[model samples]
Target: MPKRYIVEVDGVPPSPSPISNAVVVGNQCWISGQLSVGDDGAYVPGSAREEASRAFAHVFRIAEAAGFSRSDIVYVDLAFIDLADVKEVNGLFGELFPEGRRPARTVYQAAKLPFGGRIKVQAVAPR
Candidate 1:
């Protein structure tokens, strides 16, 4: 079995709990859900679209920390506070994974998110 490694980014504030942003084993990385929280540990206020964008950015950051890129992502999971915002989320997805190279995705609505965030995103990438 390949050894597993925890991945963390410099300058990103640690979570209050003992959860790694991502764990890598062999060539595959499992990323934790990324939210719209700023570096100061506060939830960023914005529309669902903006918050989703930031959350995806964090996912990309974690992927990069694990020696991968957004293009390496094979799967993505997104949670939104409002299902009505699916269109906005899809737009951001199109922007991130353009030209029919999008990854497998599962999107749904959540009753509530940590820190009252509007969106949360997690991804799996294979190096």
Candidate 2:
């Protein structure tokens, strides 16, 4: 049987709920939605782009912990409290992935987010 591994970001607190930050099954990893909760265990205070950056950082951290490289990530999903932040987040996204190396992306607007966060992000990587 293929082993299952739980992946967590170093320096980040475990979730208050039962959910794993991410899980690896064989060559694939499924990452849970992440908010910009910093090492201090508080939602980061900043612009939408800044918060989104930290959230995406969590996603990548979990991916790496699961033995997947940045380029190995195949898909990402993003949720924003306001659609106005999409352009800013897109700029950061372009910088992170760049051209042909970009992962498949889906974006949505949320009526509300936990911790009153501005953004939430998740990723998937399969090898």
Report how far off residue 105 is in candidate 2 (Å). Answer: 1.2
The C-alpha TM-scores of every prediction are 0.95, 0.93
* lDDT (tens digit, per residue) of candidate 2 on 23-121: 898888999998999887688768988998898888888888788888988899999989999999999999999899999989999999888999999
Tens-place lDDT per residue, model 1, 17-66, is: 68999999999999999888788767898988889887888888888988
Candidate 2 global TM-score: 0.93
After TM-score superposition, the amount by which residue 65's alpha carbon in candidate 2 deviates from its true location, in angstroms, is 1.1
Candidate 1 Cα misplacement greater than 4 A, ranges: none
- Residue 9 lDDT in candidate 1: 86
RMSD of each: 1.1, 1.3
Cα lDDT computed for each candidate against the true fold: 0.87, 0.87
